[model samples]
Target: MQAFTGSTLYAAIGGLHVGDMLVQLVFFIILLILVKKYAWGPIIGMMQKREEYVANEIEIAEQNRAEAERASKEAAEKLRQTKEDAQKIIEDAKHIGGKQEQEIIESARQEAERIKISAQEEIKTEKEKAIQALQDKVASLSVLIASKVIEKEINAEDQEKLIDEYIKEVGEER
Candidate 1:
């Protein structure tokens, strides 16, 4: 019965006055609004800026990747061209060497032919001179034999008659 009496002591003990509860509720709402305005706005803005910076970095990396690929392709093409040029140069050198070898062989053949012709001409000239010398020697030997035979066998009168007969025989033979 004393506990149930309606007085300041009972009100405090029960914890149920309408005016105090309403005032506490209003203060709590004001504190929530202030925290939203002062603390949450800057944090949201900073997050947005960070997201934009990350996106820009990704784009730059993609561009650099594409440039590197292009440079690599160009280098590969240049290497192929250099190999082709080197092959062509080797082929040209081989062709030139073959042509030079042929030219050398031809020149050697021409020189051999010239030497053969000169040797043949020299042999022919030597043969002609030898034949002429042999004929002259035979004519002089025949003259000497005839003179010795006539001196051993004939008088002056017989020599005169033999000379006349020889002249007649020579004219008939001719």
Candidate 2:
């Protein structure tokens, strides 16, 4: 290599110089002061705003989750209530149906008894009418026979005796 020179970097391609180093240091110090005054505070404020926004979103999400849980619990309770109501309605219907069925059966039984009694009464009346008709026919026959016998005898006493005898026969038959 060549001998080291007193001109420093002026004598070499990549060597550092004192004057350039001093100017670089001064420029770096000014740039650092400008960034701290004009850029650093705003950047920090933007970062803080982003952090607050993220926190707010997390809180909202938690509230939504709690609301969803509460709604689900209410729905479960409502379902239980609806089922109970449905069961109560079914029970009431069954009870009403049973009562109605009993009433209908009782009514039918009463109607049947009334019809049976009516039929019995009609039969009794018809039997009495038949007996009366038979009695009338026998009385007429006895009167005619006694009248014919009396005509042959040609006596009032015999006619009355025959009529009494025929009447006694009719009574015996009855």
Candidate 3:
């Protein structure tokens, strides 16, 4: 090979077809412009839309989670309130039951007292009737003795026989 010089190198490079290079470069620029306008722009826009959709879905999921938590809290509060109400109802029922028991006991006591008082009154009335009957019998017996004494003067033996007969009659009537 001959030693290269700057001028010779320039002549060699210049020997290529400049018009063909210029035409290929222009076509390449046009292809790049078409790709950017028709393919690249749409692809980038689709990607942006996909990103926005994913972000929106995530936000909705977060909101749903918060709503679920709030509902759970509300349910817990309602349960607590229901428990309190149930406890209160039980307490009230117990109080009412105790009051009714006390009333029943008091009523039974009063009834017993009344029964006792009625029995005592009945016994007293029966005793009074027995005493009155005994008094009438004694009065009749005294009148009979007076009439007998007035009818005749009795000796001791006759008096004893009369007494015995009166006793037998009184026993048979009883």
Best by TM-score: 3
lDDT per residue as tens, model 3, 6-95: 767668898656678899999999999999999999999999999999999999999999999999999999999999999999999999
Separate clash counts for every candidate: 0, 0, 0
Q: Rate the local accuracy (lDDT) of all candidates.
A: 0.80, 0.88, 0.90
Clashing pairs for model 1 are none
What TM-score against the true fold does each predicted structure earn? 0.60, 0.68, 0.70
Q: Score candidate 1 by lDDT.
A: 0.80
Candidate 1, residues 1-174: lDDT per residue as tens digits? Answer: 355556765577686767787899899889888878997788888889999999999999999999999999999999999999999999999999999999999999999999999999989988888777656655654575478566688678876776676566545644
Candidate 3 regions exceeding 4 Å error are 1-33, 150-174
**Which residue pairs collide in model 3, if any?**
none
Worst lDDT window (10 residues) for model 2? 7-16
Stretches off by above 4 angstroms in model 1 are 1-39, 140-174
Candidate 2, residues 19-47, lDDT tens digits: the string is 89899999999999999889998999999
Q: What ranking emerges by lDDT with the best candidate at the front?
A: 3, 2, 1
Residue pair clashes in candidate 2:
none
TM-score-superior candidate, 2 or 3: 3
Candidate 2 vs candidate 3: the lDDT winner is 3
As for TM-score, the candidate ahead, 1 or 2, is 2
